[model samples]
Target: MIIEELRDLIERHVRPDMSTPVEGVMIARDEVSTLEASMSGTVMALVAQGRKRLALGDRVYEYGPGQYLVSSLDLPVTGQFLDAGPDRPALGFGMLLDPAAIAELLLQGGAAAMPDGRGTPPSGIMVSEAPVQLLDAVLRLLRLFDRPRDLAMLAPLIKREILWWLIVGEQGATVRQLGLAGSNLSRIAQAVRWIREHYAKTFHVEDVADICGMSPSAFYRNFQAATAMSPIQFQKQMRLQEARLLLAASPNDVAGVGYRVGYDSPSQFSREYRRQFGTSPSQDALQLRGGELSLAAGLA
Candidate 1:
């Protein structure tokens, strides 16, 4: 079976850090993991063994063997390994999705066309069953490790093949829009980028809408649909995540970290921090330093 072959290849080639010879590929092997925040970018995560759950805003997604997850935009997400153990660890492969590569394939135009949505909006994240062809392409990509001579020439080609499969799969609409120049997804992505860059500063919706080339109302609707959160909520997530990173490095300067991240009142900052992370900022820092919490908790 393709799943069995993929499991074997991943287990053999995957190092403890999940790095591989392939440039944009990584393998994950975890015996156990807790729900932790991490930044998920444009990538496809295919699980060959065990199960995992991911939370984006209020939405929760769970997948297991023969399944895959696609995050079309960069966002803060909480992930947990649901079923893993020392004897049977959670194993998965992550392949970064390149919009440029997808654009090139779109120009060539030989594969299945994307389904029409008739103005329906698409979300940034999706989960679906991994098709046999996709699994086969992943297997071939991993197999390149066995032939160092063929890797340089073949890796990019296989990577494109894998993306092509995704472009025609159930989540094609989301993947397809990533390459379109003025797509709704692209516009929302622009707004998302602006918010991330200027998260600490307060901005009005009209200004952000102008940046995205949309009216206030339309931008709000589409942005909420794409990201599962309002623009202000998105900014809050970014701010909180950045504060967590700052606290990780300067564990003792809780008030300074909060103020630096735009929190004016120390009490308010502590209150919101506890709400977002389920613990006080000071305590979270201690746990992080003691190695009890995942470093990913600081990522956005």
Candidate 2:
């Protein structure tokens, strides 16, 4: 019943406008055809009327109405909306997480007790059942869209409330570490940010590990634990993903696209690209041009 009510409210409020800050837009009417992965920004997503599936490395997750997904670090992720219909297309809201908001909430809620025993590393991403209060808070936030005048005055309060709920809710520990200054997860997240910003530039693992404040061995272990991919593998994914975008953008040289993304040898680039994407860049680009590539692979 709550889900149904929430669904209706979402359908009404989540308009097709793409002008919202933090990529908060309603994607209800169209069926997404591609399975694409982007540099996973830290964010929160709640589906009020549909199910969505996401793949991170070898692990996959699905969440539907009454559930929420949080990404604490930026990593590569393959995502698609899995279930929605014309009667009720997928209705959802996403807010890119602001680390400052997390930190501010931690400072405000400090009673000096670690309520969630959140001392260890947490998965980079997590999903948990939505608490009623949290869901209600979000409903009020969406209602603000109906009154643009009120949004300026009331939106911050509601946004803070959402962050607070996440800090104290079932997955609080994970959210908590997200803001902790020197937590392991946060450190690794720093390295992740560096890689995303400079994926096309060559960098040594030692330098990255140092930046994350971990020894090389420790950094590698934790990075793999969190992402299930080696640092090189993660960087490779970023490069290949970028290359695919470039290929799709125009009739460019495949070898040039590879080299532009830091690949030194065209032969090596073609081999790796084929291995990761299951088709040669030349062939995939051809399929993409002919409209024969599946929506999922096209997204990749």
Candidate 3:
């Protein structure tokens, strides 16, 4: 019954952009779609219907109804709905992970709630089947959409309960890292932020490592472990994704868009963009303009 109601809630709330009246929550219904490239963030996602698959670096993850996925940090990912269209669109829910709320729960829960020593930080993304309690909490949270007055009053409480379920669930170790100050994941998060802000500029790994309070070697290894891509590779992905976003708005200026996103050579930019998206910049732009491709909604 939880799955059925959950699907009904998501279907009723689904929007073209998947935005919901509830902040930090999303409901998506798709009539199938092509593989899409995008960035993921710290968030938890659950499916009530159909199946979805995402690729991050060399790793691939797939989850279907009654399953959930969590990303502990922001990372590059490509994903798609594997089934469902028109007669039975895919249905899903997403909630952005809030470190502050997780930290508060950790404080109340104390050491018993924390995962063991950092060791090698867990991978940035993980998938698990949704337990009943977690699904129930999500269902209750969605019910507030029709109860606007109670929504502002009770939504946060339900959201925290959903997060608590995640913290203590199978991927507890991965979820805990998001709230642990100075954690390896947190440190890598700093490095991720630095690179994202300065993605277009050149910076040595050592300098960025120092910024994250990590040695160059440790930073490189952990960054690779958490993000599944080398620092250089991460920057390149950012450049390509940004170029695509710019292209959506200004499809005519392929060279200018490429250069602005930090490519020095239009030919190289075109080459890499094609390698990444399987289409030339001009063609992808055309597809994007024609509404064949969209970057607006991913697991993040």
Clashing pairs in 1: none
- Clash number for candidate 3: 0
Would you list the C-alpha lDDT of every candidate in the order shown? 0.84, 0.74, 0.88
**Model 2 root mean square deviation, Cα atoms:** 3.2
Q: Model 2: per-residue lDDT, tens digit, 206-270?
A: 99999887889988988887777788888988898888888886535888898889899999999
**lDDT for each residue of candidate 3 in 151-194, tens digit (9 for 90 to 100):** 98899899999989998999888888888887899899888888
Clash counts per candidate, in order, are 0, 0, 0
lDDT of 1 by residue, 1-300 (tens): 889988998889989777789888888778876778777877899999988888888999898998998888888788888878999988899988887888788768743365433343587888999988999999999988999999999998999999899988898888888777667888888898899899989899999999988889999999889889999988888888899888888899999999888889999989999998899999999987787877562111
RMSD of each: 2.1, 3.2, 1.5
Arrange candidates, best lDDT first.
Answer: 3, 1, 2
Query: Cα lDDT for residue 109, model 1?
Result: 70
Candidate 1, superposed: residue stretches over 4 Å from native = 110-120, 297-300
What lDDT is reached at residue 196 by model 3? Answer: 87
TM-score of each: 0.95, 0.87, 0.95
Clashing pairs in 2: none
